[model samples]
Each structure stands twice: as C-alpha cells, then as structure tokens.
Target: MNIIPILASAGITGFESPAAEYSQLGCNLDELLIEHPSATFIGKACGDSMQGVGIFDGDLLIVDRHVTPTHQDVIVANFNGEFVCKLLDIKRRLLLSANEKIQPVVINDFDTFSIEGVVIRSIRCHRPSPLLSNK
Candidate 1:
C-alpha cells in the first residue's frame, strides 16, 4: 500500500455550509483498509451469490491470505478445482452461500478443500464509465 501526503486542508461539503477550521492530514486508505499488504490480493467478483450480504457482481474483493478465517467469515476457497466465494461455517463444516436460492457447499475432507484467503473488503464503483470516441 502506497501512501501520499495530504495537500489540501479544506473539505468540500455537500449538505450544509463548509466549516472554516479543517483538520490537517487526511487519513491514509492503505493504512486504514489493509493490514498485511504482502498477503493481500484483489479479485473481481463474478457472480450474484453474495448479493444478499451486500457483495454484488463486478465488485472488487480485497483478500488477505495471512488472516486466519473464523466461523461465519466470508472467505474465498478452492473446492477441488473450482474457486468459490462463501461464508465458512466451521461448526457444521459447510460453506454457506449468502443467496438463499443456492445450496450450501459441504466440506467433506479438509485435505481436498483449500482456503485461498478471507475477503476483508468489497468495493463497488457507482460512477458511470467514460465514453470512448473513435479518432
């Protein structure tokens, strides 16, 4: 995570009138969002299976391989040859899907299944894409 110095002091407000006194040094996103940068990787979500949990398709998932996944934590796992993003239910030993329509994947053997990483955050872009014109 690369961090840059905060240049501007005044913050642009939306609702009310802007305040005269503004705090210096805006917080670093890398310091706030990520813990282990070496183990962190980003993956684009491909399906709507996690939409119920606010994780939609085309979202960018920040995964940390160093973080040990606990029960009920959303994790990315490799079941056999396929990669799946779901919640871990350690007590029942099942991979729970956020979507009710989809059935939960059962973890039969620990040897066959591999935990790729835990999804720390999900980011979605709300702004429209810039139109490209032919020269």
Candidate 2:
C-alpha cells in the first residue's frame, strides 16, 4: 500500500479585508513533482462497469505510475494486453464492483494479472465538451 502525505497550508489574511495573501504561502512543488512523475491522462471512461463507484463516462482519469496498487482502490491495468479500469481487490482475490449488473472479474491467479497503476485523481466536466477535437 503506497500512501502519500498531503499537507494543508494556512493562507495569509489581510488586515482590512477578508482576502488572503497568496505570496506568503509556500508549496514544495519540487518534491511533489519528483514523487508524481510520468502522469498519463486517460481521456474519458466509456463503460458502466465503474458507474456504481461514481466514476462515469467522459471523466478524465489521472493515472500515476509511481504509486503502488492497494486493495479496494480503483486502478487501470493491462489484462491480457488489453487496457481496463477496475477496482483492485488483492486481498479477496476478486475485482469487486458496486454495480451488480456488471459481474466481478476474479483474479484467481496472480501470475496472470499485473496492475499498470493506481488511479490518483479524476477530473469531471460539468458541461458537455469535446475530449479532443481535430479542429
């Protein structure tokens, strides 16, 4: 289980107004960039297999190769040379899903399975937009 620590910084408040000063806050961008390298932006999830988990179609998924896969976490993997997004169920030995309509895929043998990476974040657009337009 790979866990990343996230620190919250306090913002500076102005004397006369409620606005905060942005210049005073400092972020360790270098450390963050080093740990989270080589991010692959997978454009849109098409299938309903992950719908019960709140991951819908046309949602942008941020896949980080740096993080290790853990139980119950959603991940993108290459199963039999095909890319698939599913929940990682390393303990139960089955990739379980909240949606009963879509059957859970059991990973009976670990040797046959290889996790590409765990999903770090998901970006969803409120309005309709093209994922990538040729024009």
Please report the candidate that would top lDDT against the real structure. Answer: 1
Write the residue-wise lDDT of candidate 2 on 13-118 in tens digits. Answer: 5444333323333446333334475554454576778888888877767777778788888988777667778888887777766578878887766536677777
lDDT of each: 0.82, 0.68
lDDT of 1 by residue, 1-135 (tens): 334443445666454432344454555777677889999988878788999888987787999999999999999998888888999999999999899999988899654799999999988867533431113
TM-score for each predicted model, relative to the true structure: 0.76, 0.64
Off by over 4 Å in 2: 1-35, 110-112, 131-135
Instruction: Compare the candidates by TM-score and give the number of the best one.
Output: 1
At residue 81, give the lDDT of candidate 1. 81
